[model samples]
Target: MAEFDLIERYFTFEYDFTQASNGSANNKSSQKNKKPKVVKGIGDDCAIFEIPEKYQLVTSTDTLVDGVHFFSDLEPELIAHKALAANVSDLAAMGAKPLAFTLSISLPEVNQDWLKSFSEGLKNASKLFKVPLVGGDTTQGPLNINITAYGSVKKGRLLERNNAEVGDDIWVTGYLGEAAAALELYDKALVQKAALNHSEAELWKALTQPIPPLKFARKLTKLSRCGLDISDGLTADLGHILSKSQCGAKVCVESLPVSEALVNFVGLEQARQYALNGGDDYQLCFTASSKHRNKILNLAERCQINVTRIGKVQDEGLQLNLNGQPFESNRVSWQHFNQ
Candidate 1:
């Protein structure tokens, strides 16, 4: 797509402030009154501010290295999107609304096209989440993108994984296994179908863009006991929650929500495994009281998002069960330092 088309199609719709930086005086004035304390700084700067009464700022950062977090040949814009989305996912895990972010990018060469596309994607994501780009750094090195996202939660409202209770219902937003299916297509021998059903373009889109669910964070904190984003597969990431919560869980394999694209690419059994153990999905997996069932359902319907009740918290330990038997949830992911 052309740069203008990309900005209009993807970035503009999600980002509220896309036109704010277009050298329009009215747009600049609109920005100034929104948050007065953010002091202006130069060179991709984010203005620092204090919210005196309502909220406390929550911050998180993530780093993506070439040949590790993503492929070198992938679109620069998508890399920027994914890098920012990953950090947004962290904020969502805390049930925080993103306010702004700063980016630090290191590159081996100065490619104008790459920078343009990357900035567009980052701007798009920031706008979509109502986050403004405050500041950043650029340097020459192997391709790496580091983003620090700032958000806020109403006094003491941030959710933590350690707050889960034994009887809480385990829920997850969106279907699983799409990202894993996209990864499988990277291998020619695997020859998986596209990411979405009945469209090669749609499949390619999912592979290129994974939407991070920031909208659900506030509602989730209200409805859930605890939660986390499903980055390192459901089984693996939930293990962190369960371990921290001092509890165990039973993931009903039969209840996992799998995409039609996944079922077409891999058979039922392996597809279930991918949804269970595959990584980088970036969806929210949470625990809520059974009493909040109606509230959660209403929230999902209002948001037009799918949330599956895959399992329940158990008092014993982390074990997944299907039919009448017990299974393991201690699957390992691609650890940064594997022995």
Candidate 2:
């Protein structure tokens, strides 16, 4: 199909942001703002976007290539959902409200059914996150999905890796390692979809339809900016926070919250490794003053997500403790080049 014809047939639409559920799927905070303003969208020479006054614009981009990011045999809908969700996860990590997004997709060829499913998947994610798709490009090439997500946050409220302070308690939302475990199972041919048990099914959801904890992150922004989403494993991603904050952490290994699914599949010891080293969890990891412990717990309740206190920020060196003994070793994170 011709590029313009493809977009017109599948991608073009007038989106209604107001009809969307709030960024937090489970609960709505009184302070949650309205959907971001869209000045103009697709079919224009340039898309226009505008947020209300007193908010700073934040943007993030991510690219997914076949074989590297996912198996090419994966469904087009799964591909589309994950391509967009990864970028949205970045926005959540920064504690920003979803504003708009642009997609740049390159497919080897235009298959009608694939395009239909892909567009529907995009629509589903757009509504779920309450973010509009404004403009993007479609081209013919190696199958690739690149997305740039836009967001807005109140001035001086940007979450980042550089603000975690010594004595602050570190917390993470939702279970970790399940997504990575799912990938391992599938890649190793350890299991098949039809044969998946209940716990395995949950792992598959984690691996595929991973949810960004935007609601919990929104609440967290009000309390602190020392936060990020775990795309790489905790040991590696937290290392970025520690390196940037010019501090270190002493994590209690036994405190790392993980789903039973991971343990069932990989056993406790390996599950801990995956929890510490696995990527694609898409859950938020943040730090706040120890005084906010009670408030953080309440916020988690309001968001209807489990938040676990796993460690405390400290000075000098990174340490992992397990049963009163030091654990963790030279950790390696997801790297595109180094690998």
Superposed model 1: Cα runs more than 4 Å off: 1-46, 187-204, 327-331
Clashing pairs in 1: 14-128, 15-127, 15-128, 44-135, 45-134, 45-135, 46-134, 46-135, 195-203
Q: Count of backbone clashes for each model?
A: 9, 0
1-339, model 1: which lDDT tens digit per residue?
443343334333232333323233368554443431333432332455544355678899988988778886776778877888888888888888877777677778766687777778777766667677666666678988888888777766787899889899999888776676676555432244343346333334555577767787777777775888888788878989988998998888888988776777677677788788777888899898999999998998888888899999999566677665765443355457661
lDDT of 2 by residue, 57-163 (tens): 89999888898887768777877888888998999999998888999988888889989998998989888898888889999999888999998888888899999
Model 2 TM: 0.92
For all candidates in order, the CA lDDT equals 0.73, 0.85
Highest lDDT model number? 2
Candidate 2, residue 339: the lDDT equals 69
* lDDT at residue 237 of model 2 (Cα atoms): 89
Worst 10 residues of 2 by lDDT: 22-31
